[model samples]
Target: MFPPKLATATLFPLTLGLIAHFTIAQATLFIDSEHLPQAKQYDYIVVGAGPGGSVVASRLSQDPNINVLLLEAGPSDEGLLDIQVPYLAFDLEPNTVYDWNYTTTSQPGLGGRNILYPRGRVLGGSTSINLMVWTRSSRDDFDRYAMVSGDDGWSWNAIEPYYRKIEHVVPPVDHHNTTDEIDIGIHGTRGPVNITTANAPYPIDPHVNATSQELGNQYPYNRDMNSGNPLGIGWTQGTYGNGVRSSASSSYIHPFTSRPNLDVLVNATVTRVLRTGHDVETGLPIFSGVEVAQSKTSSVFAINAIKEVILSAGAINTPQLLLLSGIGSSSPLAALGINQTVDLPAVGQRLVDHLVVANQFAMAAPEDDLFEAIRRNETLFNELLVEWERNKQGVMTNGPANHIGWLRVPEDEQGWKEGEDPSSGPTSPHYEFLFAPGFASTVAGTPVPPTGYFMTIFTVLVSPSSSGSVTLASSSPFDPPIIDPAFLNTTFDTQVMRAAIRSAARFVSAHAWDGFVTGQAASFADVNLNSDEQVDAWVRSQASTIWHPTGTASMGRCEDKDSVVDPDLRVRGTKGLRVVDASVLPFIPAAHPQAVVYAFAERAADLIKLGRHLC
Candidate 1:
């Protein structure tokens, strides 16, 4: 097993360094109670300092007159070291007080396994804990969002500018410049967030390259995957600057925290939204302020909002916060002895996340193995850290899994038939492949190596047909909520996942890999090959999520009773209230959520600013 603290020490310093450099972005925020004016009102109050919250805060505060308040339950990320390196995220662990440390209630299909889920508890939230890959979905994904929200502006064309507005791409240097082989028109240059491809000393496994090329050659219209159309396999673009993570706090919020109008409260846990009087006669209620309790303190205080309340608290927290504030299923709240303020039945419904079926195989040789270096000598490990800290170049700066692909399983295959998008454009697929250079010996820890040096080809099922729910585990705000992801609950989801695993393995076995693979010292040949049942079993044993959870407070058309937010992201039936986060996505985005969340927040900030002008 890998040393536990090895990952933590390597990643922590970079995390803190980024935070100290970026806390100024939240300068407009009022962190102390003494700063609040009598019955004070602000132009906007954004909760949760994650991707959406930070972006909204950064963008809305651009106007010198507008006052923005950003509240986060976690303490400032300052001085936290492990979060800085891109590759050491796994070492931070569920034990770190900065993690929410959520666990699934029970995934019925995975034999009731309760997997550990970690959400960032620091100022930047999960973005600080993420892999930092800047991946975008196919254009159709946004078009579908526009269709669901009844808004024409959500299409790919409508939001591309926002994506470009938040990114600053570091050009490829040296032999790593595959700019000739891939498309670059889709990337941005002068944005708040810095993004770039790295040329870490790690060599691309010849087998991996040949296998991916073989698949592309077999498929038609196999364009570069990072292009607007993500059909073929390619290297992943990452969100990093000088080899360190570029979280929203580090990129967008950090630069502007010195403003006097902004106020940020860390370690404040909001119990519920305070209501003045229940419009009992009309069954409608008005929210006045939010009740917050400082972590490890009994002093609960209420902070009132003057103008509008925004919930950018992420998919899980946004909905849960709503329900705790008596804005959820009436019956459930009543049972918990809480009076219902707003009967929004869908508050905690529609939990969606990506599911993956990973296939692991033994490498033919261990010469280039990551484990060989780290395990063999402490100096090699220290050198890796120095390389990242001083030069911002090395394995620590790049993700162990640096390649990604989008694939369409044969429609005739079992589960692939059920979740087919009738509206899909050419080259889009319901399946994705995330290739990594290591395997896991246990689910509770970092990537493993004793399986004799292996690679994991994880197939993710996006747009899963199955739906799940998030509910109160108990009446208390401190109690963790019940999360039922319902993985593999649908026959179609399982079928497509199985096929994806087979395809990934088949590519490795093909003659195209004969020259690259060589079969010399391959470790996993003992396993059964060319059998669907065997592939299915192995998939279940190794699969893991890419950690993209969305749709808890999904947006929808005005008439849809289940909708939590309007297309503009306002919480229905409440004034001066809105939710600008991943929870607003009606469906999961086709790619990583960090980029899209940034785009959405940019648009939300514009809407908030325009609305303020009208007032």
Candidate 2:
């Protein structure tokens, strides 16, 4: 076990150094509303300290002459053990104070279920609470963005460097050499966010790898999925180092808090983007100002940005803020008594999210079921927690999944509408599978069995055909927006999910798992796997989100009527305001979106710095 003192000793100097630096630099790191100067104007005002805002604010403030202010609606991420621990990620959502705790409207496709949607509300945003999976998706995913926006900057060739710029590969907690596990040449050694593989090996790791080899080409063994070709079973990479979560706040904001030009304000919510004036030639409204308040009833504060106001409030809140500011469809704003600021009707449309369904199977080797053992035995769980706190090595250092697989539906099997292929290209995945060595339930309120050991295969529809929206529930900024991800709404999405479930079954049916493998768990025992109707019904009943939401404020050509933002990520029919987050993705990448968001923000910072010259 690592000595507890060693961890403290390592952090103490860093803390002290930050304090000393702040004292010498005389720079304010955090500011409350009462201390904020009313007359001062900032060069840039970034709303929401998520991956997008954090990178943008940090990169922009690199220029010593630029002053940046970042506003977050939630509390600080420091000292939150739940946010820092990778294994504790599951405890931070679904009505936690650190989460937005929003729920989707009832959906017909989900058997009239209202899914619990959790978005991070802290300094690091969702990166602090997410499962920590780091996937950049496929190369074609970026090329499609370039093709749709008519800008080569978003292509894989142009954006690949940003991925290297955003990641810093670190050793896992166990300190084992990862030469064969991942491709070090493809990752960055000197970057802000730290990425690593699972620390201690799980008992099922060998079985999974063996199955990959036994199952032939369809389940090919991928040495590193993050190498722009994510098409097979490979080790899962995460944004964590030394058993500690490396969130956006920790990577981008916390390290540079002592910079004199940057100021981060927690518990300060920007209610609306205040329009300052109209452009002399284009007649576009200038949204260089923002209305902020500590609470819904607190005193409203008006702040101006001399350069721009960047919105990084995730997919849900970005559109909500725009709609509240009268920048959405004019018809709805008129009914809500809000004067029209922009006639763009696509602000809250095109919301896309990955839907997950868990297929659990009983495991014959109960002794090797680490996750089930921990859940059943409190003493074992406490001992493991102590082990992690002491030496940062144990099950606590990893998330639920140890490996992930991205696969495309066979070309002949694709059941999409004619000429309506949703995937970016041939390399893009139609669905994904996360292999968890324990019962992994995406749906809330599902009870774990008391005695039996189990493993789960999480089937995720990456290229979803069904789209939804984020619209105003009320005119008040305090009200939560009505979100409708519309999971499994289309026959195409349902067919893809059914295929994923069948593929997962075939994966575990390999000769390598003859002894250890058991039949399906009780939850899915009755479902006829051979029947498409029964399989689709089971999927609809069990489907929930992986929490990778995007495309609410999608980027496209300026003349595209359905696009909310242009290729530069500027809001249509508006000036001096832009969006830099997952919300700007026209389509959700065929993997987790955190890594993509980081790269996007890195590129966005360069574009914003280049200004009109690039636009």
Candidate 3:
């Protein structure tokens, strides 16, 4: 066993540096089973090395006495150059090695079209492929979950400290660090993950900023959204370190790669969670181990988790893995030729995600052409590349989707919060607008014919009312599960999005975008500006998802029979099994869930440690 000090988070960076520059292989354990010589057991086995799994494994292994085994189905994030650059996330998706690139079943609500769902198949999971924005959902989101789960301490105030605990905010340099522009009491200064705001130079689009201000002015309750209120136009803050993508791997996993007890097995596809008993009358199945097949060798192996089997395989994969292990709906298990051990009817229910639209507006630039920058800027490209290589700063470091705004549905809008509920009245939030500053377009087929230059506003409907589900594709572990978000299926969801879009269009007409719009930028020239039907029609055709899938295995009170996990994050009917990922959320947060998941996992770790201490 290694010393506890060597496993500390502060030492992680140095250990990772040693692995990257000086070491060949970090360390290896010998496992010589009769059928599978490579099969091994660990004190804690975390499936999927995404944000949640990475933190859990990294922190748990720090105890020195505990050995952590992290298994990822994707290839190693060794030399993915685009992964290092934030703007290049778009280009990296089509590459098979880096992204899972799964598509959902044809949505009945989305004109019967299958939406392309890109998930990071690399070490950091979606964080590697995702736009590196790091906004947390409003505090009400957590309180709502807590209320549903009947867990008192699960509220935002109870968990907000964890966000600060894991966060290490890197002060902005020059104009980029808008700390003065936004509030900081709610943010953190010292932590593991680095959070920074984008300051890449773009002419201050008056219309965009002015319109955003107007919306806030008109909706005074939402002014200063970034001040833990999240209700107006603002610059986007994200997990970018001097512009390079700071994914969970770069910030969490990679930093601990050299730890003696933390073992990571990449490209290992887990087949099933090994369980012993089937009859609940007798008892819940004892989670013995995980059966996995090596991607390179196609050889099956069984690895045991001596203490716990935590599923951080994400919303889709986590439920599917559980079902394969005989822990899901009875009907589906029987249909797929799998025996049902635990009839958890809600293993893959209550799915929710943010539906977004790439609102494209054409603009004549003052100097540099937009298409020219994406297609032909050799000098600019090379200069930015060299700058990043030398100093880790530039446009290359910023995500294509930078700058965000948060807003609430109008009082007249569907699902609008009617005068503070008599039972559950006034509430505070972190932020609501998920704004970005790149031209948003479809990625399903060959890219749309490019307009010369445009600044697209991707307004994410974060607090969506529509919910969907995931089901087995013939119970096969290898088969991709069927996911249908049923976007815009509800009148409440549709109306809320319509209000958001109209509000955004108003902002475009505002002064903030005046200097930015040199030419005609409106796409809907035919639609009458004042007509509600025209705006609603435009919204229906244009809206798409922001790709933040969650809530397949929600945490809830005992009364919620469909809930897969308890508020403590333990599998409802099973012992020694817990889920510590986005799937546990009862509802989608009003902001991005990256920071929320980190905070949730931290609280989970503390709870587990507390339970152990009592023992």
- Who wins the TM-score comparison? 2
Local lDDT at 150 for model 2 = 86
Candidates' C-alpha lDDT: 0.70, 0.86, 0.67
Model 1 stretches with alpha carbons more than 4 Å out: 1-41, 172-175, 219-226, 276-284, 412-427, 445-451, 515-530, 612-615
Worst 10 residues of 1 by lDDT: 515-524
For residues 264-358, could you state the per-residue lDDT of candidate 2 as single tens digits? Answer: 89888888999999999988789999999888889998899998999999999999999999988988889889888888898889999999999
Clashes of 2: 1
| Candidate 3, superposed: residue stretches over 4 Å from native | 1-40, 173-177, 204-207, 212-215, 219-227, 277-282, 366-372, 413-438, 446-451, 518-523, 526-533, 612-615
How displaced is residue 102 in candidate 3, in Å? 0.9
Scored against the true structure, residue 440 in model 1 reaches a CA lDDT of 36
After superposition, the stretches of candidate 2 with alpha carbons farther than 4 Å from their true spots are: 1-31, 37-39, 613-615
Residues 1-615 of candidate 1 have per-residue lDDT tens digits of 112345233444656666776575344544555565555456767789999999888787788888877888887765455677776765655678778888887676776677776677778888887777776677888888888888767778898888778878775433365564345577677887877665464433445556655665633323345455777666667787666778888776667778656667777787777775444554545575787877545678877666677888887888888988888899988888877777789898888887765555565556545645465556777788788777766777775466676777664654444435532555457677666664433245544444465555667887576778888876778888887777777766777777776667676676655533433123234446466666556545545555777888988877777899888887777665788988898888767788878888888888877773211
lDDT of 3 by residue, 329-432 (tens): 88878888999877899898988888876555556662433324544445666566567656777666666544566665544544545542211113432123
lDDT of 1 at 423: 24
Best by lDDT: 2
* lDDT, model 2, position 224: 94
